[model samples]
Target: MSRRRVKPSLYISVDIEADGPIPGPYSMISLGAAVAGRQDAGGFTPADPEEHTFYRELRPISAEFDEQALAVSGLDRDRLCREGADPAAALSEFTAWVGEVSTGAQPVVCGYPVAFDWMFLYWYLIRFTGGSPFGHSGCMDMKTLYAAKAGLPLRAVAKGTMPRHLLSRRPHTHHALDDAVEQAELFANLMAWEGPGA
Candidate 1:
């Protein structure tokens, strides 16, 4: 009697720079994603973070934006207003890119405390493209993953609190592509790690 083998989940590390708290009123100024790794029955394969990547800067949706939120990303709003990709077109390209890369695996968005990123990403993909490549709920929170693997309380999970070996060597820059690359390194480390019990 042979059992079927389940395919690994293709962990896609994503980072987004947004202006304001939410999506409708605010907007995602930039987006980035990299194929972090694939973890399955056999084990894990750490992808080259530089390969299989996507990045885009989009024009603001509404006039309303928080100064602080906009300042964090350090992107020139006026420049973007003059030369940014259309939101709908950018998202459409993103969706197609996901499908192309994830031929036989499930694409899972993996980010630190994924909720914030997901909120904007999902909203944009759904609103602009009319559908999300990741669907309605395929987000993996690295913070939560670490908490479970380390057997630590969720509240106790922070980058400073984690074991040095588990964290990414790269610093967290606000640039969406850089952050996504940093997160890809982190995801690869997490996928290859064997916790307390195997």
Candidate 2:
């Protein structure tokens, strides 16, 4: 008999702290992700009871740590070697874990400043896995979505004062997991006001 597969609806909130803005030339100092499973059709609602989250820290690949980024994140490179997993190993494990969590369901992967995070993650995934399931197609940028749904001007929204304030409220602390959780909270609030359709 064939084994029955579990189809869990999942959403992933991910964040990455890099040595600098550019990829290839730069490196991902760390990464954090929060995965939640949907309990019902409410669709990523705050009230949903069937949600689980996990966090992981990755060791830096290069010694060229950006002083400003490091100061904000407060992650010690020496300590990361002791506490965090290897970069390639961590990415492999994380991708497999996400696949397991998502299983038979199509998961929505979200990030606040997706352009930055996605670029690094995309590069890292393609570098190791040969390709990324998340390519530009599967990612969601909450800031852009919020601006559109709230009917706010792009300039005003981009400032993150009105519709995009949630992204700024938490600030970019540099810790990957903390930032991911912050994005998750912002997403929850946005979903509450705009409803699942938004």
Candidate 3:
């Protein structure tokens, strides 16, 4: 009997900036993704995040906006409305990039707090590109991962609480791609870490 080969998982660190709280009501103004690494039986192999990345600023789909949310990203709604990439085209290009980068592996989207990012990314990908390259379950939450590894309550875990060694040196700039690349480094570091005891 032949043993089936296990495909490695290509961890893509993703981040998104939106105009409001939810997908249909709000708009995802910007999106970013970086290939964190690939993991097989041997373990994770870190990637050069800058070498494989994707980013797009999208036109708002709705007129509604949240002043506080927009302030965090520092993206001009008026400017995006006039010059941003079309959602369909941007998402299609992103899907293609995901496929190209994970040709022989399964693609997984990872984020500092994956829920928010996944919500927008999945919604946009399905709404614009008809489906998602990562599927429904291919997501990893770095925050939750840290919680489990550190034996701490999920709600108690925060970047400030984590050891400096486990945290990436990259600054958490709000620019989608900058944050994505920064979190990619964090994800790689988390994967290689053996918890507080180690």
lDDT of 2 by residue, 140-198 (tens): 78777777777776556653464453442565566787778777777666655663244
Best by TM-score: 3
TM-score (C-alpha) between model 2 and the true structure: 0.76
Sort the candidates on TM-score, descending order: 3, 1, 2
What would the per-residue lDDT of candidate 3 be over residues 2-44, giving only the tens digit for each residue? 9899999999999999999999999999999999999998999
lDDT of 3 at 114: 97
Per-model TM-score, in order, reads 0.94, 0.76, 0.98
lDDT of 2: 0.67
Once model 2 is optimally superposed onto the true structure by TM-score, how far is the C-alpha of residue 74 displaced, in angstroms? 1.3
For residue 140, give model 2's deviation from the true position in Å.
0.7
User: Which residue pairs in candidate 2 have backbone atoms (N, alpha carbon, C) closer than 3 angstroms, thus clashing?
Assistant: none
Q: What would the TM-score be for candidate 1 when compared with the true structure?
A: 0.94
- The lDDT values for all models are 0.90, 0.67, 0.96
Q: Which residue pairs in model 3 clash with each other?
A: none
lDDT of 1 at 121: 98
Better of 2 and 3 by TM-score: 3
For model 3, state the Cα shift of residue 36 in Å: 0.2
Cα lDDT tens digits, model 1, 11-72, are: 89999998899999998999999999887887789999998999999999988889999999
